[model samples]
Target: MSTPASRPVTAPATALSGPGSPRPYQSYVYAYPHKTAYRPLEDRPALRALWAREPKDALSLYLHIPFCEVRCGFCNLFTRIGAPDELTGRYLDALDRQAVAVREALGDGTPVRFAAAAFGGGTPTFLTAAELERLCDIAEKRMGADLTAVPLSVETSPATATADRLAVLAERGTTRVSIGVQSFVDAEARAAVRPQRRADVEAALGRIREAGIPVLNIDLIYGIDGQTERTWLSSLDAALGWEPEELYLYPLYVRPLTGLGRLGAAGDAAWDEQRLRLYRAGRDHLLARGYEQVSMRMFRRRGAPPSASDDHACQTDGMIGLGCGARSYTSALHYSFDYAVDMGQIRRIIDDFTTTEDFSRAEVGRRVDEDEARRRHLLQSLLQAEGMDVAGYRERFGVVPAGHFSAELERFAARGWLDTAAAPGRLRLSPEGLAHSDALGPELFSPAVRAAMASYELK
Candidate 1:
């Protein structure tokens, strides 16, 4: 393992220029550029090697269901809208086959102990109750019955989450469900291309709770065109009224090829500073109502149930992303495959399984060294409300964070954006830091990593 080097006397500060600075905050837009570029699978050997190296108990599984009844204009995830019934049936067949193939590729002796399993997509509930049961049966067989105690989470749209679907999920050991309740107001919901009624949203929650599933997470979006502060506040109030175990507050991002992107280009959609102000207001409202800020975009009731604690950041301690288009990372190399339903690439990856061998040890070592310790700490730290644990950092990375990013840390500290304490040794963001957390990633990412990521083409 590499140790953190002592701080140099002089190191440049990498903090982002403030919102209105000449070097506008968008300058860091591609700081952590998408390495896969949404391309098809071409790296099966590396991915398999990563899975093999990961401590079995450290792995987590994510299954993506890409069929949605209606496409939200703001959504850019890999999902098929209005997919044919035959295609849905075929997709489930492919999923089962893929699960079996992964099991075989992982080999028999590898003791894979999953800590968490999540089903996300267009909507996992889009599958029929029987289809979901079959998929669960496959998972139990391949991933093992031992996962019964693990935290299994699934995401669903309110429209798809019927009582039957919830019951199927409960039978499959799912402990939590995340429903996309983008807004409580019907007009705003329809404008965002999510036509769920307020009554339907409440009804879904009532059913999930009645089914005895312990945790319910509601997803809310801010920064949508025509979304007013008053309307947004009302939505937040409605969400709080539901008392979900967790609340995910996300800002709408208009990705390049998404429907929202077209609207923006035509000058029909716009998100300005006022939208950001609304975000801050929403955050304050949630915090005032006793929701703990778990991440930049997530809030949860204090003392949330254990099941809800198995979030992406906490589970990042280790994850074994399976399925097409899933990314897996161990303590060493990071490897991913694209399964965005691109037919040609999927065929190529499936065929390559027979030809490709394990990744070279040297290659794995290179990636580990290339991953800057300070950058990783910052990435994980900013994601949590409690911020970075200095002692934990020293234990894991064998270095003091202050010694690693001394200059940048000092600069932020001086600006009163960062607060550090002794004894337990944790660094947390001050109020100003919380307000600017969205811009922290670009500043903390190493330039070399950013450059390298920018140069990689997905296809």
Candidate 2:
């Protein structure tokens, strides 16, 4: 297994300029320009077909916990803030019903082998110790008896994690915990509406470590309104001092319908060049401290293996989701549900449910044909720190990457954006390329996708 401290720091690529400079207008539309259209979950016929055809040993799971003590200003995830006692009981009842419904839809005899199971949102720890255990038990019963041995992960806020809560998670098969430690600076934390004190964070970390979980992934955000280069760098240093097994560095995105979005709309917030500089400075600081860039917004300690990287790849593979406001994806379709209804009312209903049915898969193959080549290139490039292997591409896609992306490859090479000579079968972003990596996805998106992404907003 690779350790996180031994990876080399590649320099960021210089800006791709001149007449052929990759135009932002072409790609800056959707959060995921190439994302498949929303498919409703109520389409029973299609869902049945999916269950019948799904490979028995090839599924994963994602469970969402939607209770938070306070809502963060920048958060756009599906979660509710307020009293937990009344909410937990209702949410669990609804979750159980949904699980049963999915099980029945998939059929009882189907053998499901989950590659990974992740608990995310509000805070998995928001549930009482007993409730958490019961939820995991129910999941194990539905998936199989040996879920504990699988790669299980959960996300929690530092303020919600206690020694008891951590112990419950450890006993229930959690191998990793992603704590939302957005910033170590008190002012930044306050600005984000995260009520975590520095002491609270340290205590939470100590408890989680004591529980024997091997991977501790911490999240740090940059490009917020009140954040400065100095504060961001200092937070980075503070996070590193904790020696987390992995780290996710995300640039703050102001999404509509959120507090931050209103601020941006009112001209009180802006993601300017200085914010970009802060992100770059923080990235450089992480790299200098022995963290390897794993994705556009993530870094891990050097020598860490792919398995130890953030759970992004596992998520990409596919996962079954449980709970209200949870999303699930198979090889063919993606579905999600809204679970913010009256918990009291939901508990009374035996068939607790709210779902978006399947929309369309008729164009899947067509879109795949048009976009798969680049999608694979970008997905692999975006997730794996080692970059794409030409031989692997040929083996999987039945064609060399150069055959499809040769023009783009040449364009990057001319600007010193790639180190093509290091190995025949490998292509990695040059340091300059890393700096502008977010632009690559947009640059490669098709015109239709670019247009669709531009006007889309997450609801």
Candidate 3:
């Protein structure tokens, strides 16, 4: 990540000095304008108008399934523990309703097309084989996304990666299947409250490989209690045995309302140091083993087939998300059904989503304006190893990032995190900057978004 020299600073900002420097690990900024920043839309904007002027070609489609067999200790996702036999059907029935409404909203105008699609949730595979087939039908028949043509990715768990469920996904043209194997060590699994034996995880992975899906993704987590470098590598090598096409190495966070949070598990500077050390180890291990780093948490095998479905950046393009836990994005607004982590509140939201007859309007959301949009563009682009394109910023916003984010860039340069020799028209992060992406991402949050996210109630 060599870059141009001497970052310039003409604006004032928070200090990122050597002494008492910010912790490398902050909140993960996977999405700009985090859901916590969203609120109930009193006006209830119609989905029709939301997409009327927005670009529709090459859109990304997502469907959320909020039911999971078991909730992990560190999980704070909007998902319930299990669905009653009747609940799954009710959920799909509701999904079909939402899809039909959304398709109608797209209005067969401006050549609407979905370039990629994903099934995510508590675990999309929580549904039975027949239910999964129905889920795909809802996306293709009702929502008008051609699953067979697009790169379709689905999330599954060790318990739910059953052969029958996987067969449905394969038949429906699933190109990628990601299973969260946080750790292959039984002890670490127990500490994470993700109850499963090594035997079961191995069996599940076998089924995934046997299913003949093109790309397989394994998700591993660092920073579990009682984890050490040796055991971390043990888990890493265990995952390597499957030669997964993609791997996500996540840093565990004991967020509020999660099992670890309830048990008072907290992060300290020492813990941060441990996670950083482990992250570097894991990263280097994968890189040496013929895996290329996509981001801090994602790595792909060197010759893996391109998975464009995962590349639909909502920061610029539009995305359509269905189901209670899913979210959608347009150029000016990001909307979702509701946001929650508490089990009781989550269940309430799921129940509400299942019985609703109308799905024509946005329930809760936040509108993105020009300035916030600029920040998002810079933040997301800079977080990548390739960095942002200077020309693209000017074309979109009529200004260069170095000038708009001068103070932030200067701070990063001072810390040696911003590349000083990147080619002209390119803004990239130094290796260290990508390593501390969690912290760097948060620093770019606009004051209003930061305040809103701060004030949001977890429940």
Best by lDDT: 3
Ordering by lDDT = 3, 1, 2
- Angstrom error at residue 173, model 3: 0.5
Model-by-model lDDT, in order?
A: 0.61, 0.60, 0.85
Deviation (Å) of 351 in candidate 1: 14
After the best TM-score superposition of candidate 3, give how far the Cα of residue 80 lies from its true spot, in angstroms.
Answer: 0.2
Model 2, position 389: C-alpha lDDT score: 67
Lowest lDDT 10-mer window, candidate 1? 1-10
Model 2 agreement with the true structure over 13-81: per-residue lDDT tens digits? 224434655421112111232332333334334445655665646566777776677767766555666
Q: Is candidate 2 or candidate 3 better by TM-score?
A: 3
Q: Is candidate 1 or candidate 3 better by lDDT?
A: 3
**Shift in Å, residue 389, candidate 2:** 2.5
Of the two candidates 1 and 3, the one with more favorable TM-score, higher being better, is: 3
Query: Which pairs in model 3 have colliding backbones?
Result: 2-421, 2-422, 3-420, 3-421, 3-422, 4-420, 4-421, 4-422
| TM-score sort, best first | 3, 1, 2
TM-score of candidate 2 on Cα atoms, chains taken together = 0.79
